[model samples]
Target: MAKGIHQEIIGRPHNLLEHYQPIDGVVDEMVDASGNPRPVWKDFIEALEGLGPEKLAQRFARADQYLRDAGVYYR
Candidate 1:
């Protein structure tokens, strides 16, 4: 079911913002007005995208588990 989805490819990952639609008259912090990712965030975004959704999810899950084990909780 996720095969055709941009973020659900098995071995290949597409641009995370391939379908990003910035609201009109809104200032986006990640991308520029031209829809290209800003230079400052380009590498960071690429690195995360390279991790793919599954790996990113796993990392986040691990982090959450660690936080819970450490007694970290949101106020």
Candidate 2:
């Protein structure tokens, strides 16, 4: 299985990374605002990174589509 650049960005499958990046980046940025690492966001990211690529991708696609349908836009 080849790892992709997007995967490395979130330390998970590329698809999963796409689904979670917004949430992750938001949590990370918010935590950073407090000048400390937020355990909730950190643990979630770690847990996501441990899933199998296929499984992670499935989740990613689902979340991605849902967000899109809901008009959740990102840069």
Candidate 3:
């Protein structure tokens, strides 16, 4: 199944929002193996969820490009 469909299947509208929180001096955070922690999502993606998949994808792509342009990320 597609990713949007998968998120719908899991009923994660709010969880998606929460998953993409913003922070200072950090990229992002997530649980790693052994119940440890790691970082992810250098930008906020949850806000785009309500914009529908196409727009969300466009926004994400744009944000990704911006991050790359700003040298915060590479390719």
Candidate 4:
């Protein structure tokens, strides 16, 4: 019975790609212009969707902490 990040941020719309719009003649790496997962990313997206937003946020926080502890930086 775990709550998701989406749950934490209640009363807000959860459009993952609200601002995404595919331009003409360009190739999208993950989702299509319609915001549907592309064929190649189907499985990966499904797995992440199963994890829910809270878990994903926690994972991201852990990764960020790890990078900070390890002194990893981007220029």
Number of the predicted model whose TM-score against the real structure is largest: 1
Task: Sort all candidates by TM-score, best to worst.
Answer: 1, 4, 2, 3
Clashing residue pairs in candidate 2 are none
For each candidate in turn, the TM-score is 0.60, 0.39, 0.35, 0.57
TM-score of 1: 0.60
In order, the Cα lDDT scores of the candidates are 0.72, 0.54, 0.47, 0.63
* Residue 67 in model 4: lDDT: 71
What is the C-alpha lDDT profile of model 4 across 11-48, one tens digit per residue? Answer: 32344444557777898888876778789987876675
Better-scoring candidate (lDDT), 1 or 4: 1
Please identify model 4 stretches exceeding 4 Å from their true place. 1-26
2, model 1: CA deviation in Å?
Answer: 19
Tens-place lDDT per residue, model 3, 1-75, is: 223233342334434445534455564455333333344532344444556655555555666666667978433
The reply for model 1, stretches above 4 Å from the true place, is 1-12, 60-75
Model 4 shows how many backbone clashes?
1
